[model samples]
Target chain A: MAKVLMKGNEAIGAAAIQAGCKYFFGYPITPQNELPEYMSKELPKNDGVFVQAESEVAAINMVYGAAGCGVRVMTSSSSPGIALKQEGITYIAGAELPCVIVNIVRGGPGLGGIQPAQSDYFQSTRGGGNGDYKLLVLAPANLQEMVDMVQEAFDMADYYRNPVMVVGDGMIGQMMEPIEFRTPVKRELPSKEGWATTGTKGNRKPHIINSLFLDPQGLEDHNIRLQKKYKTMKENEARYEAYNMENAEIVLAAYGTTSRICKNAIDKLKEEGINIGLIRPQTLWPFPEKAFQEIPETVKAALTVEMSEGQMIDDVRLALNGKIPTEFYGRSGGMIPTPDAIIDKIKEMLGGLK
Target chain B: MLNDKRIRIIVGHYGSGKTEFAVNYAMKLIEQESNVALADLDVVNVYFRSREKAKMMTEKGIKVISSAIGHDANLDLPAISAGIFAPLQDETCQTILDVGGDATGARVLAQFKQIINFMGYDMFLVVNANREETQTKEGVLRHIEEIERQTGFKITGLINNTHLLRETTLEEVLKGQALVKSVSDETNIPIKYISAIEKVAQTIPSDVDGEIMPIKMYMREEWM
Candidate 1:
């Protein structure tokens, strides 16, 4: 297929349909509204269903119901909208349902502003809802990666029988970029026949989908089982890109739109004879801690940059584990850190190390 | 040079570079016309609106009118400024109305249909063949019909402003020109301008239907 320029939100909608997602339920929100709008228009043409529910809460529950039917189902929203969907998301996670949830993050503890920000790192990675559960979170830095990850998110959700979240900032959702849909490698997915709540005739037993467990022991066992799944994901699914790691004086840790900015800064620093590397995590939940080990011995310090006031820095600290002196630089309230600002931060951190 | 119409309303598919073209057109018009006003009538898209460049345009003496709230207001509320009426009413000002993208975006123009039609404004549908919705001649026609239906106004001109951001090439521009040219022939809507980045604009042959409008990418950041 020829490459076509697509807005990130519309590309995600197209990717979901191409991935055989037959059901979509979402509400309108800035930055990510285009996804649902695109789905509402195109899904029906492909013999699928698109529902604009009354609210994000209602939309996520609709996703829960659709996923229980063993169909590829998804819902998307921005920050506050995603927060509204938390209860439903936890239910979907606890029920071990396969669905894709996308959060095109904007700033806020509460309706911060419609511009891009990476503030939802904790909400997505650390479980916003009540549970001993984990969502397989994929954070894509650009549109092409976002498209690829969104399609793959459906497969990973089904294979593991858990919800997978593809998180990007508002910039990623709003920007236009050239992208081509490629066929993803098929996974050895478990058949949904045995577990799904598809109506059974007299020939088979009826399947139930529920997150509630009255018995304490039953809930404990369920929690343990979910933890085991998360452990497997951590071992197998953690992904990151280690750019210019061959020999480096400083390393930058960032993701999503911030990572792209970091790459530009790294290139500029290289021109000035300053060797800096970057560790961009593609998967945020299975936090890609393993990539930190690849940091060169010449590295003087590690700096974590974000569009928020350092939420992902916690994960970076845990991943590095005192291997190197870790520092943080960030901008919040919908402010994006420019390449020059990032370079200055790197230089400042290097100077401090001296 | 653009059309002689006093009011030029720019409409197109989302990300078809309408805002970029509108900004460039206003700047170009300011060189000849003393009173130039750039009204951002876009209520659909929150980001990348021409109003975001209000300060710079204001510094350059172009009257920048955006959301009803204010020029610096970053809220996504669908409130357009009533101040737009002044420029439309002003006989001397060359007003560029940068409408939002798609039929949804073009619907805003309907609110001004009476004044626009009465004043004899020129509405141009900017076409980018690289955009998924406007990739084919049929798609472009569908877009035009929808916009015309929404606004109850006929498209008088076509602006081929196709691009893939900074990665735009001469071949890409030519491909877009071919698509828009076919649409022009069928619709009889004259090709008003073939807008491209300065580098690609220089490479386009004179045989192309529209006068080449070499534009600077003011809307996008350097790294974008």
Candidate 2:
């Protein structure tokens, strides 16, 4: 297939359909509205279902209901809307149902303006909803990755029987770039016959798709099983990209839109004889902490740059384990830090280390 | 300048390929003459607007007025740049106003009604017969009516720019041209151009009624 120019949100939506997601439920939210809008128009034509739910709360519940029926389903929203869907998300997690959730994150802490922001890092990577549950979050920096990740997310969700989040921001959601959709891969998945609630057939036992285990012991057993699955995810699914780390004295840690900026800053620093490298965590959950170990012994420090108030910095700190000094710089409330700004912050941090 | 209008404003449905047409049209204007200014009056849409190509346009000496805050920023807090008015007031510059999509987006045009009226501008409705919303002559007419009613600017001409993303064929292009031609016949609006992909436009028979504009599909889907 030939490459086409597409907005990130629209490409992600098409990618979801291409991955065999037949049901979509979402609410309108800026920076991510195009996803729902595209699905609303395109999904039905493909014999897929698209419901513009009354609210974010309703939309997520719809996702839960559809996923329980063994159909591939998805729901997307921005920050505040995602916050509303968290309770449903936790319920979906607890039930061990597979579904794809996309959060084209925006500035937040409470409706904090609509430009791109990575403030949702802790909310996404850590359990935002109440419970010991984790979403396999994929952070894509460009439109092509945005398209690829959403398609891969559906498979990951079914593979683990857990929700997979394709995390991006307004920059990833609204930007237009050339992308070619790769041919859909045939992924092996667990048969839905055993678990899906497809209504009672002849001699088989009815499948009960519910998170409620009234008995404390039963709930504990379920939680333990879920934990075991998460352990497997942690062991296998952590993904990261390294750039210019051949011989670096400084490492920059970032993800999604901020990661792209860091890459540019790293190139600019290289021209100035400053060997700055970057470690971009493609998956926010099960973060590629191992990449930090690859930071050369010559490296004196690591700087975490973000569009939030240093949320990902904690992960960098945890990854490095104080073997080397780690510092943070960021801008929040929809303010995007430019490459030059990142370079200055890197210089300041390196100056301090020296 | 198909209709000899100094300021050509392109309007259409959300996915009607308006931005792509506007970009190609702006490039054509620049190729023909020097003083060209493209105003990104599309405050309604956050993506795929002419502003995304501002650097390319400006590098070629074409003045561009887009987002005041940041480049390619989808900020909901729309702050229209004041420089948009300079081209409107200037007589020499061949200005192109790329308005946002649909009736609600056309509401932004009301802000420049007074200046546009005083300056005498031409509004062209770009139609994509392939779009689900405007697949027939009735649908096309209804959309045109709705856009005109909302924007309060009667469209002066029609631009047929139908396509199935990058999968468009010569047959589909001709089918779309026929639909838009029916619309032109019914409404008496001049068919300014029938936009076809570069390959299709080259092969279009000379007997085709309107001017054929060979456009590269700048706005496209992932799997072309």
Candidate 3:
């Protein structure tokens, strides 16, 4: 099949459909509206359901209802909208219902402008909702990756029986790039016959789907189980890309849109006799700690760049664990630093390290 | 064939493929000269606008002028680039204005009315009959009237850009062409061109009312 030029949001939505996610529940929000819009039109054609719930809160709970029924279900929203859905998300997480949630993050804290932003890092990686659970967060840097990750997210969600998030800023959601899903995606999902809240029949016991555990001990046990699953995800699903790191003296840590700029900066700086490389984390939750170990013994420092002030830097610091000097630079409140600006910051950081 | 209009303003309802037409048109115009500029005057939609292709267009020697604030900025605050006037004054260059999608989006063009009037420009209204609101001649004219009223500009020609993304078939093209013909008959405005994907373009009936503009689906959803 020939490559199709697709915007990030629509691509993700189509990927969801092709991934066998037959149900989507979401309210419209900027930078991510194309996603739900696409679903509203296409899902029905595939014997799927697309419901525009009254609110983000309502939309997520709808996802919960569908996921608890053991079907591939998903929902998406921007930052503030995602915040509204957190309570329901925690419910989904606690219920151990597999579902895909996409956050084409926009500037936030409260009704921030509808622009590309990475300020939701802490909200996403850390539990945004009140819970001791983790979402397998996949941060895609480009349109193709966004499509691929969303498709994978559905299966991963079912594989772990946990919620998965494909997080990116407005740039990834709105930008157009060539993408090809040459072959159809087909994943063997776990059967929900034992746990799904389907009607009781054939002398089988009724199934209940609820997040509540009034007993402290049982809740603690559930938390430990979730932690174990997270540990396994960190060990097995941590994904990152190493670019030009073979002989680097300075490494830049970034992800999503900022990482693309860092890659550009690395190329330009390398042309000027500078030895710089990029460590791009494709999955934000499983922070790819192993990639940090590949930064080479000759590297002097690592600079973390983001659209947020300094959220992901904490993860980079944790990954490095004082193996090298970790520095941070960012432009927040819907502002993106230019590649040249990042190059200058890298030069400054490298100079300071020396 | 559209070479006669050096300054063409493209307008349509949202999802009518106006930006796709504008981008492709800009690419076409640049084949004759390097002094071409495509101005993205779309403040209504933050996504799927011509500015998203600015970098690619620039690399191909066509200047892309977008919002004064920035191309990547998603804020709905409407503002035009001051540099847009340069192409308007430059008779040597061909400039295309990709106005926003609907009457609400077209309202931004009113700000440039004075200059547009002084310079004289041709405006094309793109119609996709597949869109629910514009499925009929009455529906198409209703939107055209609203856009004209909103921008105080008249539509000089019509572009039948009817498509269902990659699923667009020859039948769909012919159906849209017929609907566009009815619209042209009612308004007496010329059907400037009819668009289709490369394969469907080859099957356009010989007696179709407008010139054939075979376009690749540059703006698409992954399902296509």
Q: In candidate 1, how many Å is residue B63 off?
A: 1.0
lDDT per residue (tens digit) for residues A1-354 in model 3: 544546678789888987888999999888888889889989999999999999999999999999989999999999999999999989999999999999999887799988789999999989789978899999999877888888889888988899999998998987766566633355677777889887876678879998999999999999999889888888989999999987798888889988888887888778998888889999998789899976788788888899988999998888888988888889987787788888888778877877
Candidate 2, superposed: residue stretches over 4 Å from native = A184-186, B1-4, B12-40, B47-95, B102-120, B124-224
- Quote the true-contact fraction of every model: 0.68, 0.22, 0.19
DockQ of each: 0.74, 0.19, 0.16
Q: Which stretches of candidate 3 lie over 4 Å from their true place?
A: A182-188, B1-7, B11-43, B47-74, B77-97, B101-224
lDDT computed for candidate 1: 0.91
For model 2, what is the alpha-carbon lDDT of residue B185? 94
Shift of residue B168 alpha carbon in model 1, Å: 1.9
Scanning candidate 1 chain B in windows of ten residues, the lowest lDDT window is B1-10
Clashing pairs in 2: none
How do these models rank on TM-score, best leading? 1, 2, 3
Local distance difference test, each candidate: 0.91, 0.85, 0.85
Q: What is the DockQ of candidate 2?
A: 0.19
User: Tens digits of per-residue lDDT for model 1 on A238-272?
Assistant: 99999998689988999999988999999999999
Summarize candidate 2's per-residue lDDT along A145-175 as a digit string, tens digits. Answer: 8788888888888888899988998878876
| Residue A185 displacement (Å), model 3 | 8.1
- How does model 2 do on interface RMSD, in angstroms? 7.5
Q: Candidate order by DockQ, highest to lowest?
A: 1, 2, 3
